[model samples]
Target: LFVAGPILLVELYPARVEFAFYRMSLCTKLGGLCETDCLTFKEKTGSCRADLTPLCCRKGKKH
Candidate 1:
């Protein structure tokens, strides 16, 4: 049931929409970290950046 449930859920959504949803969800969770010194420093000074992290401001948009 657990395995099938996830597979079925993934199949239910279009690939692009599903990937966007996942990215948005991840961004929301990571957005809270923006207040931390590391993220804040990079945001303000534009240095010491982490390439993998998405900007909190870019929450959503049409592709």
Candidate 2:
């Protein structure tokens, strides 16, 4: 007979959007380009995404 004391299980979610946001990688994936500084940009027309590295500069004007 075999006996087990305890077991731990962990599950990873790859389809989740929340987990998809990784550094600046998500920027281009979201149709936005990554920039060093948004203020230094020529256009300065787009906005930045939350908690993104190198600044995820989104295209189009703000509403």
lDDT per prediction?
0.45, 0.48
What tens digits encode model 2's per-residue C-alpha lDDT throughout 1-63?
A: 123322211123333334435544666667767665654433333333434434666655546
Q: Where is model 1 poorest over a 10-residue stretch in terms of lDDT?
A: 40-49
Against the true structure, candidate 2 reaches a TM-score of 0.35
Please give me the total number of clashing residue pairs in predicted model 2. 0
Model 2 clash pairs?
none
Q: After superposition, how far is residue 43 of candidate 1 from its true place, in Å?
A: 3.4
**Candidate 2 — worst ten consecutive residues by lDDT sum?**
1-10
Q: Which has the greatest lDDT?
A: 2
lDDT of 1 by residue, 1-63 (tens): 989999988887676566655655665565533222433233322211233443333223235
lDDT of 1 at 43: 36
Q: Which parts of model 2 are misplaced by more than 4 Å? A: 1-21, 39-53, 61-63
TM-score of each: 0.32, 0.35
Q: Candidate 2's C-alpha lDDT?
A: 0.48
